[model samples]
Target chain A: MRDVYVIGAGTTRFGELWERSFRDIGIEAGIKAINDSGITGNDIDALYIGNMSAGAFINQEHVGALIADYVGLAGSLHIPATRVEAAGASGALAFKEAYLSISSGMYDIVVVGGAEKMTDIGDEMANYITSMAIDQEWETVFGATYASLQAMMARAHMERYGTTREQLGMVSVINHRHGALNPDAQFQREIKLETVLKSGYVAEPLRVFDMAPLSDGAAALVLASGDVARKYTDRPVKVKAIGQASDTISLHDRREICTMDSTVYAAKRAYDMAGMGPEDIDVAEVYDSSTIAEIMAIEDLGFFPKGEGGKAVEDEKIALGGEIPINTSGGLKARGHPVGATGVAQIVEIVKQLRGDADRRQVKDAKIGLAHAVGGSGATAVVSILEAEI
Target chain B: MNMPRFWREKQGRYNLVGNRCTNCGTYYFPKRDICPKCHRKSIGKMEEVRFKGTGKVVSWTIVHDAHPDYKDMRPYIMAIIELEEGPRLTGQIVDCSLDEIHTGMRVRDTFRKLSEDGKDGVIFYGYKFRPVKE
Candidate 1:
């Protein structure tokens, strides 16, 4: 397999983009990525989009064709556009496909993007639709919401490791501080631990502040073969390795509730492929749809020992400018989790840090970065390792 | 949300019916054609088993925000119960307040109305758990 490198990345401000339509945000991000890559739309060879529930959210399907046509790559260009979905990890799966396309010599230049228009539907309906990612018959049929599932994990983590509510609150406080520095983040104000503790409960043990808000946004990346990467940009971030894995869709089926086995498996494979350990990573972007999810991710990714992730956060080890800076883009917590766009957005943040472009939240002299994305209750996980070319 | 789809699961929903894998001696809630652990080895050898519905709560949450279908059911308690047969299932823990529910509390399955599609539409009924009375 040939090596793949990301030449450009772009993302729209994440929030309740009520005025923008699904295709509109998708096109905007795509165009920005193309422009950033110093290439024209005509230079793109293929397109892959990651969208979780466009059909249910907006009453539209065939989004691959819709995005391709809306982006002016139809007819003569005939770009083979594909749509990939794995719940929240849709964006990372799309990026993985684009990387494979370039690495397998199937395509030299590929545009990978992820978008979600969540606010188009009301929150109640959106909640119901999002639950479709899990076992609809068994899980959702019994009235299980996503927050409830994550809450269950939080409860288990607390009981097993004696994780405190304050430790979980610390994750939110730190992420909001980083989000305050991010101009494109949805929630740009720093929050305190007291704010999280006082927030009304959405699910017990998980307050409104502990959960990621429903967001609508898009993120895109331009990937090229390593040999041709220099033509687009002088600074290219190499995709050193990528790993994807799946677990039982239902949380009840998992062998252990506190630990997400898929994340552990994917990270192990990714680390092996990259010939680097978790300690070697200079910066990391993890899926923190909920605060407890972040703690579990840190442990599952090997960044912290099991059951000690909460303590690590309290010690300020994972904060920006700390030992191992994480979620410098505010993570899904404060950065906004646009479901489909989150994974790609994570990559965009990493690329910015690797290029030394993240002014306030940059990890000093960052060379290697890791991005982790998970779907459902750890049903699917994707881990990618990237290194700065210079 | 087809009627047949809901009707097909009536057995598992109404009764605590599941399947046990003879090869691995593991039980699965909602039954299974093949055991996840034993795979093909347990295929065709799976036995329909009925759970006693007695179990302990493994974890739980008080959900204040939920799907529109359960709008009236907000602030409900959902729990993962480890059944006496060793299979775990998610069910609403009724007849108990958020303050009363705790992990390791003994509970028993009870049938309850889940939700209705509309006034004249089908009213779905499923199994829920309630704390075992001393």
Candidate 2:
């Protein structure tokens, strides 16, 4: 296999986009990415879309075909289009497919997009739909909601490792601090640890402030084979490696719930492929669907030892200028997690940081970055590593 | 879920029946066909093994937010119970207050109403946990 390069990226403002239609925002982002890459629609060989549940959100299926049709790449243009789904990790998986196609010489240029319009439905139905990511027959059937699942993880992590509520709250506080600088972030304001602690309990050990809000947004990336990347853009972010893994979808099925095995395995694979270690990553965007998740991810990804993530947070080691700055994009918490779109948006943020375009949240002299996306309660995880010129 | 799907899994739900790989002796709940570790060798060797309906709470949470359907059950305790048979489960811990729960607390299964689709829909019944008699 050969190398793949991300030539351009485009993303929409994330929040409850009640006025924007899913297809319209998707097409808008696609057009932006295409324009950024200096590539016409005719130059695209294939289209891959990462979407979690358009059927539940917008009552639309065949999202890939819908996008292809709306973007005017159908009929005579007639490009092959496919949709990839893996709950929250949908975007990264879709990006992986696009990268593999280019690396394998299957397609030279491809447009990979991740979009979700979750605000169309009410909060009650939206919360229920997100719970579908876990085992319905076993977990959800017994009142194991998505928040409840993470809550259990928090309880266990606290019990076994002494991870405090204050420690978990630091994740929200720090991310919100970064989110304040993010132009497209939803909750673009700083929050205090007290704000997280005083918030109502969605589940014990997890307050409302600890969770990422439901959002509607889209993100698109234009990828080209290494051979022709320079023809499109000078600031090409090389796709150094992509790693993905899946474990038992149900939290109880796994022997442990405090740490996600999927992230550990996926990070390992990516690190191996990239020929680097955690110390080498200058910047990272981790799966922070909730506060505890960010804590657990940093540990499981080998950034810090297991059970020490709490200390890391308390020590302010994860800040922008601190060691291995995480979630400079505001994370899913403040950036607004539009689920499937989160993974792709993470890559977009990394590209900006590497290309020296991330204005306020830029990590100085950054050359390598990592994006970690998780599906459900630690079921699926995809870790992608990207690099720029040293 | 639809009626047929719930009906098919009713046996395991009610009895807390887990399947073990005869080849490797690994147990799984909501019983699956293949053994992840043993792979092809354990395909036909999987057998149902009924749990004693008793376990210790490995972790727990008091749910304050739930869908409208589970409104009455809001603020209830949900826990991860590790059974003697080795497969863990997620369920509500009943007949106990939030302060009464902790890790390693002994509990036993009780058959109860899980949920209903809607006012006109099917009612699903399954095993939930209650504090075990010392």
Candidate 3:
């Protein structure tokens, strides 16, 4: 297989973008990435769109064609657009498809777009739709909300490992600290530990602040074979390795309740393929749909031991200036989780860091970066390692 | 869920019926055609078994914010229960207050209304856990 590189990355500011339509943000991000790569629409070989529950969220389907047509690639250009869905991991999975297609010589260049408009619906409806990612028959039918599932994991982790309320709250605090510097972050102000701790409970032991908001946004990436990438951008980021894994959809089915086995397996494959361990990573972006989720991710990614994630957060080990500097874009917690767009947006943050474009949240002199995305509790995980051309 | 879908799962929903792999001796809730551990070896070796519905809470949450369909049931306790038969599943723990519920608390499944299609629609009944006082 040939090498694949992310030539350009672009994203819409994540938040409750009530004024923007779904197609509008999609085309905006896609066109920005295309323009950044110095590539014309004719250079794109195919389009891949990542979305979760657009049919349920907006009562719209056929998203791949929808965005491709609006971007003017489906009609005259006649682009073959395929929509990919994997709950929250949709974007990274779509990126994996594009990466593999280019590496396998099936396509020389591909544009991957991830978009979700969640604010169009009410919070209760959105919660129900997001819960569809879990086992509907056994879990949701019995009245389990999305936060409740994560709350169970948090409860288990606390009982098993002594993870404290303060530690979990710190994850939100640190991410919000980073988000304060991120212009695109939904919550641009830092929050105190008590603010997270005392917020009204959504699920016991997990307050409203613990959960990521239902956000609306889009992110796009331009991927090209290594041979062709240099012609477009001099600072292309190499797709060093990509790993994806799946676990049982139900939380109870997992062997370890606190750990996301999918992340453990996926991160292993990514480190092996990249020939770089967690210590080699200069910066990283991980799914923090909840503060507990971030704590579990860092441990599962091998940045810390299994039970020490809470400690890692409390000690400021995940802060922008701290060791490894997790979630420089504020993560889903503060960055806003527009599920479909989150995975790609993580990569966009890394692209900026590697290219010295991130103004306030840049991980200084960063080279290698890792992005982790999780879907349906811990069922689906995709880990990708990117490296600067330098 | 639609009528036919709920209708098809009546046995499991009502009786805590699950399938067991004869080869691995592992049981699956919500039923499974293939045993992941045994893979091809356990194919066609699966048998339906009924659980005693007695288990301890592995992990749990008290939900203050509920889904639209479950607004009437706010501040409810949901848990991951590890059945005596060895498989775990999600269920609601009723007939108890939040402070009384603890991890590893012994419980038994009780038949109750899981949900409904509407006020006058199909009232779906399923197994929910209640604390075993003894």
Best by TM-score: 3
- Model 3, CA-based lDDT: 0.93
lDDT of 2: 0.92
Task: Give per-residue lDDT, candidate 3, residue B45.
Answer: 98
- The better-scoring model by TM-score among 1 and 3 is 3
Candidate 1 chain B lDDT trough over 10 residues, lowest sum: B66-75
Taking the tens digit of each residue's C-alpha lDDT, what string does model 1 give over A112-231? 999999998888888888788888888888889899999999999999999999999999999999999999999999988999999999889899999988899999999999889998
DockQ of 3: 0.91
Each model: TM-score of chain B? 0.96, 0.94, 0.97
CA deviation > 4 Å runs, candidate 3:
none
Interface RMSD values for all candidates: 0.8, 0.9, 0.7
Please write out the lDDT profile of model 2 over residues A34-103, one tens digit for every residue: 9889999889999999999999998999999999999889877999999999999999999999999999
DockQ of each: 0.85, 0.85, 0.91
lDDT of 1 by residue, B22-126 (tens): 888998898999898888898799999888999999999999998888879988998999999898999999999778999999999999999998789989998
- TM-score for chain A, candidates 1 onward in order: 0.99, 0.99, 0.99
Off by over 4 Å in 1: none
